[model samples]
Target: MPPFLDREEIAPRQQNPKGYAQWLFTQVMLRVNVPRSMRDSFVLEGSELRVGEDRFDLRLFKRIFLVSIGKASVPMAEHAIQTLGDALPLTGVVVGLGTWAAPPGILSLRGDHPVPGRNSFVAAHELLQLMQTADEDTLVLYLISGGASAMAEAPLDASISSEDLSAFYRRLLHSGLAIGKTNVLRKHFSAIKGGRLALAAGAATRCTVLISDVPPGRLDIVGSGPSLADTSTVEEVRRILAETPLLAPVPEAMARFLEQMPETPKTLPEGRLPSTSLSLLSSDSLIEEAIQLVSTAGYRVIVDNTCDDWDYSDAAKYLVERAREESVASIPLCILSAGEVTVSIKGQAGLGGRNQQWALRVAQLIDGQSNFVAMSVGSDGIDGNSPAAGAVVDGSTWQRALRAGMNPQNALESFNAYPLFEALGDTVDPGPSGNNIRDLRVIFVNKQP
Candidate 1:
């Protein structure tokens, strides 16, 4: 397996508490391999494909259409193709934020992320065209992951330009709304979201293989559930727009579109929806691996997800206090939390993602306190607009930043945590892990002597 965290990159700053924390993080990341997860979750025998407890016979289908989207699209599609080799003729599209040299029968397409652009429109159009080719005898295999909301999007209103769609996504990102709520809005505005993708492939046998990046029990929110039914309604969208002033006063054309928007399909369209859906990995998968590694390292592991979607500062305060209270002289403790936090940008935002922002806040709270380290990292290896995956900080981080002529408070307020962490060599740079299972956080409380 390739090392996700570089020991050399972090060696200069590793010392005592920071060294142990960085070492633990590096160990955990090295084990959280995406291709390994894919391999373990899928197995093929003869003409039968086994995904977890489910099985699909390749011989039963005439043509197999593979639609892979999101950050992990390329890897997931490649693995699926390898697993189903010679069983069926596969033709499909791989839409992703990054580029990949697709196999012979697959079309590799790039799409805009964080916001939709002209490329997103083109990709979505291609997917629609491909879906139209499916019929009663066709089998559609959807390898869906996170980031697909923007990576493949088509406006519900034909009058809405690509620029307006981009603006809509920008508002959603900065609106401080939770991902579920954000996707609710996205589902209503798009043509292929909220089960519309499945709806287009009339009578086809659909199977969805997911790498969930949303919280558990809300798998549909992953990639706005393009192949699954939606439970959210137009009424909820309007209410969200009304309450979230950040998203209010939308463009006139956009406002009109939402006002007249129809609700996403609440029930699956018969014969067109998924016959079987398998979730290959999730936030729990990462957290479970971290728990085992931490336990083996002799620290007592505690899984806490109470602040899954809380604001960055609030989550930092809660997790820090929890770690302090749980710490004891007899045994060290590792508090592991998964899922994402919300960040409402203040103004013209600087370069940082929610994970780095949260890590910075924890740094402030733990300043001068010995033996405590806090880390927040994205599983996909790309955090927001910054290049770093996330960040790691211990008790000494605050003082070190100040000594380095860096202002942590100013950086946090400006959403500029990347530069501060980078200057201190505390940023975790993993560079697109070909995976997305949400964010993972660790609060390590070393035993007091």
Candidate 2:
């Protein structure tokens, strides 16, 4: 069992499919051990530091700096300090969702997420100031994870107000664009994104350790590639802005700002770029662990990520149909998918997220069926504007909602899934898990009589 899950809360449903699915989720999450992964990936022996196959002699550098950002910032920073503090002179900054009691040599600051605010600007300013301090003799270590884009941001143009920056993010969140495209626009708009952060480090020898939340092989998209080279172009940003109707709500100042905005750095000179980088954890790790847990429990597991960037309703239909076709009456089956799904908020979005919305859609489709349960959840333990991580739904969920005088159709349409799930006691609420890879969806089919 994962340390984060509440066993007592899940005890009552132990005999049901929902309980089994929740248990599997907890087990899979337990495998996302950030500290252990960091320890395994980074090693310090004598004055030499080994990161994977690369080695760096710490004695060559005049000073070492560490920058930790995103949801996993606290744990990642904590381990780095514990491991490297005694051996090297370390000073750094951490920007995350909440306040933390930072170590003696570190500065801890909080920033807003899912949107940028004044605090985000402050954090960005501090990070930029620190990065500017590094020179040829400095070695900078960056610990980046999901949510960093919103946690620390500064508009590339100084004239862009914080309100306009927040509006840009808010529009992007509801735009239904894929994560990659969303970040492309973000990189163009920010001074700290793309390869600009590396540029700020000057000629420092930099190393980055990432906990990736983007799709497979898109490591650069994680935290908008603050230290890595950017592959996207300004033309791509223009195309996205022109094509996305959801971005219509963006402030007019944003348009004016973009018109004069210079392209983000596409290539960094020698020494300005990271010397080595490692993806310490990702959705692949989460899915791999989930497959093992289900297989060990005697279920035939099928893995598919085809629905990754699809709209919530569309993904629900595709996965549910696939589950029905693949399920066998003689043996239990579990279908797993890991990656985020897109949601286009039409008007005022109610209190829910893509995970809850998708699960609710699946509930409607499987309504009169038996022995089927579908669970969708975010690894971070918070889903969109809702307090729940996501939600779980079985074949009977529709009828249960109806008996309680709730309209599933109305709830899904208005993006108000949290209240519906909460009323049914099916919302997956684990609080913040202090980790993020991406979202996970599980479809379980029990053996038929």
Candidate 3:
């Protein structure tokens, strides 16, 4: 496990609501750590691999190969190796968005995130070559997590250039459309996504393990459901393109591929392929554990599941209003939310993520309320264009920024909350978490007598 904020360090800060909020954030992050989740959910019994209740008999396969993609791919592959040993061979590729060093025997490759790049295309080609030789006697251990959609790719048509795909990704990312919508559009454009990878594996038995980063636990949206079956139709893609405001600016080749959509889209043919199974290693399960911990801490906890899709500014307003509506008698209230929020950059770009921007907005709203302390963080330990996981702030944040000769409104307007938080020493940087479970937000409301 990586070095985390020690409980002792947090203990000193816990005397006030501001310090306690940081401690609570650390607790929430600990619950969803990737290695712990993988070990808890997977077990090995001789030649049989048990993932939760599902089991795969490795004795039946002549060879086993691991194909991992996403932010958490390297760690996940590590755990799989620890569990199965020689039962599963590690002669496969692992692609992700971090500086993870793949263990010997496993090929470690870097890939782009938020948008596919040249390296991503190269990784896709490599995976395709490996999948082509997989026969019925072989088994592919497919692992995927958040960011897989952009980490690896093979265009449905060879003519779709990387530059064109990057343009499309930028539009979708800025469109503020839901991830599900964006993923659906992405699957149509990629050869490795939307079950194309599964198809390429042919008759080889596949066991897919997922560390889900999608909301509502939709398996299809996680890493664009690379090794799993996709039930989406071309009509769905068309609908998303038509409904979402220019989310997908189709290039000529991509536009032509849409016209070639098969009557029945190519998905993993479950009945036709050798036996395949899926295990959900983790999801937003951290939210439930986080709620339990907060309740045990004596504060009244209010969990809002609807905060995931709201714009950062809107979410900040709703959270503040909800806190205000609560009765004064219930002091030390904690409002918890888990979900990803969209940030549509305007004017000159700033070094901040959605969480920092949201925290900044909340800071602006509760500028006069010293009892309020709010924080938002990406579980993956990376937030937008900034190195900080996110930002935490209270009523004093505005005054602190003013003291630094910075205008809070100007910072927020430019999507530059990272600098303000850094100056205030309020940014949370935990390094790469080896996990991606969306975003976690905690708002502390402690009314004074």
Candidate 4:
């Protein structure tokens, strides 16, 4: 266990939202990485590993039906099948772009990510068909991760085309609106997200196991809550689209879907329960592991949760400024934080996420300073709009940036952190961490002179 998030724990904060977002992400990651934590935190059960009946029971259930969707779903599904052998008659589907293969008994459908395509539509239909088996006797295991919304598709009532939906999602991903708002728009366009999955599985009793990447751990947001009920209405989706000017208006098809869609029914089916029993399997589960690793390396650890509602660039600037202002002038501390940050792209599409941008921006601010080192990365390894997880920066970071003809401020403004880090060779390449809570930021200010 790490220290609490406050002065009593990690001292105070200049940017509380950034700390809060990171803390929120850390909590989610911590839960998923530790199996025991899963049992303790949420009523988490799978056909494979049954912690207890209250959470999930392998011994109590008979025929099992599994639907694994999104980037994390395949890995989660793979582990689930391996955990439970013949407990329940298992058959399932996994849809995603990653290498998350299916269990022996489970079927898999890989498709596009951050955008929709023909493959995505086909897979979505297949997933809906798979839910046909949701009956009273069925025990459903729903594995959801980030990017599931695009992978598992059910068009808005007007029937948006795959190309159009893909276009819309791409615009949103690049629009710089936060994931929360993006998801609000997504819920309106899709058939399975925003509690749509729970609605589809309305026929059977369901147990939803989720890996939350969103800041606010709303069950309805994770992979659109495949086994959960949705409260977001078509009108709400319309409002989100209207609110964010960066993103285009709802496509004609989606507008029609929003217009024609009926109010949700009160009672949900077994496949879609009245209220699906969903558990947040993990958010920032690895913070303890990270803390253990960092603490063992001979540095103090500060865990903060003020990660939400802050501009990452500004937050990084404040922390660096404050560290420079300290009387000791330098501190040997590893400021550990977690949370997801949003990047609004103002320039031509730059390749990076909020974490990478934060690292680069911090480097620029500390360009004249000495011995400041930091790394901001997605725990899952894939930050945003890039292949690498996040970024790491030190005093020489800007020097390297100059050598490579990369302007740090320009990159930050353009929202292209990955390219800048690439030029400086400071990328934090961990691939996909498999478990995603949100962002992980490690700032080592004046650790070495």
How do the predictions measure up, each by TM-score?
0.95, 0.96, 0.93, 0.82
- Provide the global lDDT of candidate 3 against the true structure: 0.79
lDDT of each: 0.86, 0.87, 0.79, 0.64
lDDT of 1 by residue, 1-449 (tens): 22464443343222465665566556666666556777987789777778777777777788899999998898788888898887888899999977788888899999899898888999999999999988877888899999999999998888877788899899889888999999998998889999999889888888888989898888788999999988889999889888998876787888888767888887764443237788888898888888887787788889999999999999999999999888887788889999999999856999999999999999999999877888898888888899998999988999999999989999999999999999999988767877888999999888653
lDDT of 2 by residue, 184-282 (tens): 999988899997888899889989889998998987789999988889887898888889988874677778877767877777755533488888999
Which residue pairs collide in model 3, if any? none
Q: Which candidate ranks first by TM-score, i.e. highest? A: 2
List the candidate 3 regions with Cα displacement exceeding 4 Å: 5-8, 12-14, 88-90, 99-104, 246-249, 262-267, 271-283
lDDT of 3 by residue, 1-449 (tens): 54553433554334666667777768876776778778887789887888766777877777777899998898888898878777765578899876667667777788888788888989999899888988777778898988899889877777887788878887777777778778888888888888888788888877888877888657877998888778777899888888865454577777887888652244554422244545454435767877887788777888886777788899889988998887365457888888888777644678888999999999989998878889898888889889898988998888889988999898898888898899889998887777887888888777563
Ranking by lDDT: 2, 1, 3, 4
Provide the lowest-lDDT 10-residue window in model 1: 5-14
Worst 10 residues of 2 by lDDT: 5-14
RMSD values for the candidates in order, in angstroms, are: 2.3, 2.0, 2.3, 6.8
- lDDT: which candidate is best? 2
lDDT of 3 at 344: 71
lDDT of 1: 0.86
Please tell me which model should have the higher TM-score, number 1 or number 2. Answer: 2
